[model samples]
Target chain A: NAGVTQTPKFRVLKTGQSMTLLCAQDMNHEYMYWYRQDPGMGLRLIHYSVGEGTTAKGEVPDGYNVSRLKKQNFLLGLESAAPSQTSVYFCASSYWRGGPESTDTQYFGPGTRLTVL
Target chain B: AQSVAQPEDQVNVAEGNPLTVKCTYSVSGNPYLFWYVQYPNRGLQFLLKYITGDNLVKGSYGFEAEFNKSQTSFHLKKPSALVSDSALYFCAVRDDILTGGGNKLTFGTGTQLKVEL
Candidate 1:
C-alpha cells in the first residue's frame, strides 16, 4: 500500500501566491501532521489533525492552514506564500500518541519541495 | 516548553563500526522520545521510540535508541554502520501535557551521519 503520499512533489511560487499541498495516507491513521524542514531547523510542525473534521494549530502555524475533511486526506494551504515559507514540506500520520501501549510511530510521505521567490 | 537537541551537527563513522547519534531533550513531564532518519530529499522515517517500558528500544533498519531518564537523552545507535546508513537523523519528543490527542512531535535540529566505506 502507498503508506503516505503527497501531491505536487515540487512547486515554485512568487510571493503572495497561493497553493495547497495534499497529503494522503492509506493506513487509516487517526493523526496527521504537516511539517516543514529547513536547514539546521529540523522539522517544525505547521498543523495537525487528530481525526477527520478536527484540525489544530502547531508550533509554526502562522503561514498555513489545514483541513482534514476526510479520514485519509490532510491538506495544507498557503493563502499567501512568503519567501520564508520556502522549505521542504512533509506529511506524517500515526495510529496514536505515546508508545508501547500506543502506536507512536509516524509514517511520512515523500516531501514536497516548495520554493517561494 | 518542550524541545529536543542533537548535540552533534554531523557524525562520521567507518563502515562496520558502531555509530551513535546523540540526542537530548527537555520537557515538563514524562517524555515520549523518538528517532527518525531522512534520506536526501525525502521525508523523515520512523526509527524507534521510548514510551514507558524499556530503556532500549529497537526499530526498523537495525537501529535502536537508549533512553536515559536521568540525562533526558535518547541516543540512536547501530551495531555496524553501513554506507546506506549515511543520512540525517532527528530526535523528537512529545510532552505528556502537550499530547493534545494528536502527537505533537518537537524535533531537534538534525544531525547528519556519514558512514564511510
Candidate 2:
C-alpha cells in the first residue's frame, strides 16, 4: 500500500498568489487531516474531514480551505498566500473505530514545503 | 483543549547508549498518546501509541514508550540507540472531541535526537 501521498513536494509562491495542495490515501481511512509545521512550533491542524464530502475547520484554518470530494483525496486551497503561510504542510489519515481496539494512530505523507515571498 | 509538550529542543547521545525523549500531555478525558519521528525534509512516521491498557507500548524500529497516567506523560525510549535513529521526534494527543467524527491530533513542537557515533 502506498499509504498516504502528497503532491508538489516543493513550491514557491509570490504574496497573494493562489495554489492548491493534493493529498491522497490508499488505506481507506475515514478521517483525513492537514497540518502545518514550523520551526519551534509543532504541527498545527489546518483542516480535516471526517469522510467524503465533509470538511471542518481546524486550529489554524485561516487562509486555507479544504475539500474532500472523494474519500481517497483531500484538497487544501490557498485563496491568497501570505508570508505567514509559508511552512511545511503535511497530510495524514487514519482508520478510526470506536472502542478499545482503536488506537487512532494517524499515518502521514512525505510533506510539501511551501515558500511565500 | 488537548495539548502536548516536548520540553527539550535537542538531545544528544552516543551511539549504542540508551535514549529517552520526554513528553507531557494535558487533556480533559482519556488521553490517546502517540509518538512520531521525522527525518530531515521528510514527513512524520508513526512510532508508537498508547490507547487503553499496557503502560509499556512497543512499536516499530525497536522503540517503546511508557505511559504514565499519573504524570500525564508518555516518554519514548530505546534500549540502545543507533546513529540512524537520529531524527526529530514529536509527541501528540488525540483531541477529546470524538463526538461527531474526525479524530484530530495535537502535536508537540518536537525534540531533535542526535545519536553520535
Candidate 3:
C-alpha cells in the first residue's frame, strides 16, 4: 500500500495568502488528521475528520480549516496565512471499527514544509 | 485530557552504546502510547505503540518501548546506538476521554538523539 501521501512537499507563501495542503491515503482509513510541527517542538493538531463530510477542531485549530469530502482525502486550508503558520505540516490516517479499535495507530505522510514570509 | 512529556531536549551517545529516550504520560485511564521518529526535513514515522498487551512493544528500526503503568512512563530504547538512528523522537498518548474514533494524539516536545562515532 502507498499508505499516506501529502502534496506540495515544500512551499513559500507571503503573509495573508491562502493555500491548501492535500492529503491522500490508500489504507482506507476512517480517521484523518492534520498536524503542524513547529521548530524544535512536537506536533500540534490543526484539524481532523472522522469520515467523509465530517470535520472537527483539534488542539490548535485556529487559522486553519479542513474538509473531508471523500473517504480517501483530507484537505487543510490556511485562509489567511501568517508568519506563525510557517511550520512542517503532517497528515495521518488510520482505520477504526469502533469498540476496541478506538485507539488504532495512525500512519503519517511525508509532510509539507510551509514557509510564510 | 491526555499529554506526553519528553524530559530531555537532546541525547548524545557514542556509537555501539546503549541508548534510551525518556517519556512520561498522563491519562485518566489505560494509556495508548506511541513513539515516532522524524528525520531532517521529513515527516514523522511510526516507531511503536503500547496498548493492552505487553509492556514492551517492539517497533521499527530495532527500537523498543517499555511501558510502566505505575510510573506512567514509556521509554524508547535501543541496545546499541547507531548514527543512522539520529533523529527527533516523539512520544504521544491517545486521549482517554474522547468518544468514538477520535482518540486524537497528544505529543511530547520531542528529543533529538545524536549518535556519534
Candidate 4:
C-alpha cells in the first residue's frame, strides 16, 4: 500500500495564481492533515479532516482551504499565492480513536515544494 | 491549547558517541507525545510515540525516548550515533481538547541533528 502519496512534487506560481496540492492515502486512515514547513517554523497544521466530507481548521489555516471529498484524498488549495505561502507542503494520514490515550503515529507523504514568485 | 518545544536548533555528536535531543510538551492532561525524523527533501517519518505504559519507548533506527511526567519532557536518545542519523527531528503532542475527538497534533520547530565521523 502506498501509505500516502502527494502529487506535484514541485511547483512555481506567480503572485495571485492558484493551485492545489493533492494528497492520497491507501492506509484506510480516518484522519488526514495538511502542514507547511518553513525554516525555524517547524510544521504548522493548515487543515485536517477526520473523515470524508468532514474538515476542520488547524493552527495556520487562514491562507488555505481544504476538502475531503473522498476517504482517501485530501486537497489543499491556495486561492492566491503569495511569497509568504512559499514553503514545503506535507500531507499526513493516521488512524484516530476517541480518547487521549490513542496515540496513532502519522504517516507522511514525500512533500511538495511550492515557490511563489 | 497544546504545544511542543525542541530546545536546540541543532545538535552535533561524533559517530560513535551517544546523543540526546531534548523535547518538552504542554497539554491539559495525559499528553500524547511523538517524535519524527526527516531527511533532506523528504517528509517526516514517525520515530516513536509515548502514550502510556513504560515511560521508555523504543522506536525505529534504535532511537528511544523517555517520557517524564514530572518535567513534561520526552527526550530522544540513541546509544551510538550514526552519520546516516543526521537529519531534522521533530516533536509533537496531541491536542488535549476533547470536543472534536479529532486528535489534532501540534509540532515543535524541529532540531537538526548532525552526526560526524
The per-prediction i-RMS, to one decimal, reads: 2.2, 1.9, 1.7, 1.1
Q: What is the lDDT of residue A68 in candidate 4?
A: 97
Each candidate's DockQ: 0.67, 0.75, 0.70, 0.81
Report the error of model 4 at residue B99, Å.
Answer: 5.5
TM-score of chain B of each: 0.95, 0.96, 0.95, 0.96
Q: List the residue pairs that clash in candidate 4.
A: none
Instruction: For candidate 3, give the lDDT.
Output: 0.91
Candidate 2 ranges beyond 4 A from true positions? A99-101, B98-101
Better of 2 and 3 by TM-score: 2
List model 4 lDDT by residue over B54-90, tens digit each. 9999999999999999999999999999999999999
Candidate 3: deviation at residue B36, Å?
0.7
Deviation from native of the Cα of residue B62 in model 2, angstroms: 1.1
Residue pairs with backbone overlap in model 3: none
lDDT of 2 by residue, B1-113 (tens): 77899999999999999999999999888888999999998899999888888899999999999999899899999999999999999999887855434778889999999
Q: After superposition, how far is residue A95 of candidate 3 from its true place, in Å?
A: 0.7
Sort order, DockQ high to low: 4, 2, 3, 1
- Candidate achieving the largest DockQ: 4
Q: Count residue pairs with overlapping backbones in model 2.
A: 0
Clashes of 1: 0
lDDT tens per residue, model 3, A13-85: 9999999999999988999999999866689988998899999998899999999999999999999999999
In candidate 4 chain B, what residue range of length 10 has the lowest lDDT sum? B95-104
On TM-score, the leading prediction is 4
DockQ score, prediction 3: 0.70
